[model samples]
Target: MGIDLEKGGRIKKRNRTAPKSENPYLLLLVKLYRFLARRTNSSFNKTVLKRLYMSRNNQPPLGLGRLVKLSRKNADKIIVVVGKVLNDERLYHVPKMTVCCLKISDSARARIQKAGGEVLTFDQLALRSPKGSNCMLLRGPKHAREVYKHFAGVAVEGHVKPYVRNKERKLERARGRRPSRGFKRKPKKV
Candidate 1:
């Protein structure tokens, strides 16, 4: 299902054909709404709540201050999954970064050392940094590593390979839940 920018931006599509996973941005908006709901504790005006839910289709419900606060307070390991190849965006230019894994090979470590950055584990990142802060998360396989090589002072870590494997297992289990022919009961005549 497609999301329209208008119509108060609330979830407009509701059909069986809709995508299985929820939209990331929409999820963020829902989170924001939940936060507000908790803050107001049912005292918030109905109109305002409606507006909040409606506006979620196009943009985040909270401002930058809230975003920063939430990021700084909750995040420990930032794993950036680059949807596409990296570009000249300022995201990769930050001087310091906190990563979630330390699976870099010897050659990659050498590259990072030359760039004056160090790798850290997920635990380290969580103890040191917040969740959604400026800390950039670079994700992708070989392509992500290539992007890292282009930067002079970027730290890289975290192995999503295991995570993917785990996800596949879950999917397999879900698919294996169908009923066997022996479990079916014969229909009775009316």
Candidate 2:
């Protein structure tokens, strides 16, 4: 009826300006980042603010191993992740690190502290690096979930793991699974 009526009616734009989380702490972090993102001309603050607005699935948790590997080259800089930091049992050793994340697992926190590392929250990170200086931002594997594995396979590769309801030796492992059952389809390299 107003301005958009002449140009295809009201343009329906459904997007997240702020996080949907009702948590006070999350809200506080959002507020701080919003201010920082607006006041500061740094691209890092803008990136952080955009990531902060992502959903739970969008902001996947980073593993300790991945973090260690990624921050290896830039050891002196503070690692900033817009999601939770998780513990990886596969990684035997952990080095001293300065990490800033929204959430952290107890074991992960313990391991980091045990290694003489320091953990900082979003607010603390803002205080430390208001302009997001000397920081390396990282994210976890988004499609690491089991459900994604079923759908996220190359059909041309012939090595796709299809989703099946009943996984049993009598049925699932019968036809195109093993050579003994019949003949396993070998993946043809392209």
The numbered model that scores best in TM-score is: 2
Model 1 lDDT-worst window of ten = 55-64
Query: Which tens-of-lDDT digit does each residue in 1-190 have in candidate 1?
Result: 8756554357567322222337665355345535554555443222222432432222222222222233454344343321222222222222222333324345433443444555565335433542334455433333334344445454334212222345453453344333442233344443
Where model 1 places Cα greater than 4 Å from the true spot, the runs are: 1-102, 141-190
Q: By lDDT, who's the top model here?
A: 2
Worst 10 residues of 2 by lDDT: 150-159
Model 2: clashing residue pairs?
A: none
> RMSD in angstroms, all models?
20.1, 4.2
- Tell me the whole-model lDDT of each prediction, alpha carbons only: 0.37, 0.89
lDDT of 2 by residue, 51-159 (tens): 9889999999999999999999999899999999999999999999999999999999999999999999989988888998899999998877666655635233444
TM-score per candidate? 0.25, 0.79
